[model samples]
Target chain A: MPGSFVPAVVSRRRYQILGIIALAALVGAELLGLSASPPDRDMGHLQKIMYVHVPAAWSAFLAFFVVFIGSVLYLWKREERYDLLAAAAAEVALVLTALTLALGSIWGRPTWGVWWTWDPRLTTTAILLVMTVGYLALRSFVDEPDRRARWSAAVGILASLNVLVVYKSVQWWRTLHQVQSSPSTVDPAYALGLRLNALAFLLVLVYFILLRYRAARLERLVEAQAEARELAQGEELHV
Target chain B: MTPGSRRRLVLAGGAIVVLCGFGFLLYGGIGENLVYFLTPSELLARGERAYDTPVRLGGQVLPGSVRWDAEALDLRFRLTDGTQTLVVRSTGAPPQMFREGIGVVVEGRYREGGVFESTNLMVKHSNEYRPPAPGERPQDLYRTLLGEERS
Candidate 1:
């Protein structure tokens, strides 16, 4: 059973604790962000969507940053573990990016009068998502483990570079999208709420990535064990 | 180095060069041509070059200038960047949040008469978000959007 291949980083008790924490954080953050914050003066209740949308976009960027680090380490040290970690991070990044775009589209309808626009900020983000899909596809297609890790690491590193472009696109060009917002940029009333929700989403991102990483490591362990068993049987037969 | 690893290195190098070329095309080539929208001042600065061409004009809706004929589905307003303003005409139901003194981007042609024949009208929302004050209404969101507020 795959149960025997469970990695130390993925102990049952730790997983349960993290799962519970993530759930509580998500619930508490949503409650505070939606209920505590008043309706935005201009956007009215539409601003409440930011509690989920902004945090998801931020978390996706964070996940891509993790991918960048893992890919860099894998290339430098030639480590399979780093490749697996990067792959797991990429999967989570894809999900979060999709959620970010979907949420943005939903918010755009009522506020912007359209579902999408080819503005620099929107275009760059869509490109980032496509690049991530290519990264995952490249990993899956390569047959050799070492070659797969090396090539995927190179792609992962490059793909993550686009995250920076996505962040800066609003400022670099004239677009319909608004510029970046932070505590210093927005009002104090919203700044605090955004920060709390971002932290809560961070917890959720960490839990999902670690869980995916654990599964990846277990699959690799099972593959190695099977290979070792086959080699042992061949040696005994030859003897 | 073994022949295989050397080949791998060469392949990686090639990939790097190709990606760099692509990045150049992205930011250098496409970025220059892909002007998403232009402000009223910037577009008008083009003078004769701005007329007859399809463009997206972005700026705030000048307060007290909005005219909507719901029966005719005709909407018109003066779009301004404080220093420069242009009249915009559209034929559609304005968004639910459409109001005066808020940012908007209208897509269509800039005719010779200085009216923007807009086929598409979109709101260009600011990033700032302030909670509604007690008893404050949505229309009163911007206390002073008369070209003085940075946001």
Candidate 2:
């Protein structure tokens, strides 16, 4: 067990700093996102949904990355903190994924003339959302900390792998949804703004995950302390 | 693998197969409903063969091309994308945003000589907010005429 990595508990001041950073990033993302004039000659005001929908998708993917890393750490070190972080990230991912789907649907209704379609990226995103929800449900059923961490870590790794496959599969298959626009394909003028928007969103996502992870750690510490207090009281009664 | 892990693996396998298989089917289904967008010029470029096929045409609304008959409840307008033009005829009222130079999507079948018989007409607008250029204020001429008809 030598050199096994242990979770470093986050201090309160560091947690508060993370919260402030996340708030600042969120404001920057919103400002940059709205500055761009939506694409001309189609979709109209509804095109603005792209700002929220794209960022939500980005954050969901980021959270899943955390889940993957946490799973690996838990497997290698057998530390329960990794599992708790994975659970918190999964919860946030589920919420963001759901929002992504809802916003995509709203945008689709005007452009595609349909509220929902069986597009490859859409289907994959929906599946990923469902899997994250199922992982959260599984976490709720397990009682033993070690056993829950072990089982969920396995689930987290598997789900993260599947998300990668889904992303790749969409590219391989020709479908209703258009392929992702990249710098090479995009006009230089448009790509510059998009790249900035993406970077800003990423910063926000990183800050949110750090804040949530610290909160989860603090919650676990409080629960442990409460249990210790109950045990001491029972021993005192016996004495 | 533990019994629970074995079960989870099976569940995972089922999920993958269902999701991938469904995705495959989705591609096939949307293939038929996948309407390719075309500008008026593109549609005209294709010639008479483009007729009788479902097509979506996007273009700017040409000013002075809009004509309406209130008693008959029929309306006609020309959609142009600078290089080409197509006439759109509809019995129902167009979307509120439908105005001169505003972009639109017309869906239905085209006929010989490049006339699109539209079953549906949708107005499209630029997402940018540079503001309508000076002298480009939208006029509700259609609504005004319709009001004059009822009066």
Candidate 3:
């Protein structure tokens, strides 16, 4: 068994507690959603989808950040641990991206009167999703662990850079999408509830990534242990 | 390919996908996330009451209906597909070219009363509306063109 097993146990327990807390927080947010007023004379019920859609996109951004950090660490230190963390975060990011797209489409169908648009936000999100899935595919097909780690790290880093560009492209290009909602752009009327919902969603996202990372770590440990046993049996047969 | 060379290809491919994908999306939604547009003619032919959903109606600014209540800072105009006319109300200054017969997009909710309470107004301009080649298209091309077409 790997000596790294000790830290894995503590992390697993921590993640489980976080997972429970996140679940409770999400349920609480849903209750808040119930009491929330429908859209004003302008926006309508489609505004409510912001509570769900914004958070999913934010979480996807957070996950990509994780992937970026992990990728950088792996490249710098040549450590496999960083690579595993990057992979785990990428998986979570992929899920969040999918959720964001789905929720956004649902919202768009009503507000924009179309199920999909080539809006800056939606388009950037689609690209992010495709790149993430492609990264995972590359990892699975490559058998050499070290080579996989390096290649995936490079891809992750490039994709992370793309995220920033995609974000800025709206402002740089004369696109139809509105400029990003900054702190200044956030109307005081909607800010408080939106902040609270955003906080709740961020907590849930953090909890989910941590939990998934723990599971991934456990799987890695099990595989290493099995490989060690196989090596021992081969040595014995040789003797 | 050498393993190192293969890694380079992966990076290049990733960059291409990101760049091209974003370009396509931006190109598609430019001016507005105008995925689909219904002209005034289409709206009338399909029946106004057919879909209760809110969508963008693209058409020429009807010549006479524009009236600005300057004291109240309320701008009201009529948009027509040349078939059915709909009244539009906005509280901001209309675009410079937003005079009669120019293309504009008004985003708002559709009311049962045949009114679209516009919250946002976008002036849709053609690419030719850019800085004129020295003496190519005059500053007031629309006026000149209308005059020529009439005479």
The prediction achieving the highest TM-score against the true structure is: 1
Per-candidate DockQ vs. reference: 0.44, 0.08, 0.05
Which portions of model 1 show Cα errors greater than 4 Å?
Answer: A1-6, A233-239, B1-25, B45-49, B133-135, B140-151
Q: What does the lDDT come to for candidate 2?
A: 0.66
Candidate No. with top lDDT = 1
Best by DockQ: 1
TM-score of each: 0.86, 0.60, 0.64
lDDT of 2 by residue, B2-100 (tens): 887777566655655654554454456434544346787777777766888887777777888887777786778898888777888777656544566
User: What is the docking quality class of candidate 1?
Assistant: acceptable
2 against 3, candidate with superior DockQ: 2
Q: How close is candidate 3 to the true structure, as a TM-score?
A: 0.64
The residue pairs in collision within model 1 are none
* Model 3: residues with Cα > 4 Å off, grouped in runs: A4-6, A11-13, B1-151
lDDT of 3 by residue, A1-239 (tens): 37754343664566678878887887787667646533322233435566787778787888899999999999999877788889888998889889988996776554444566554555666777887877888777565678878878987886776678567865664333445666565444445556667778788878777777677677777778888999999999999
What lDDT is reached at residue B108 by model 3? 68
Ranking by lDDT: 1, 3, 2
* Cα lDDT tens digits for candidate 2, A1-239: 11233347557687678667766766676666567544423334444566677777777788898899999999998887788788878887787789878987777666555566544567667767766766776676565567778877877887776567556644664334455656554444345455566666676666667767767666666667777899889999999
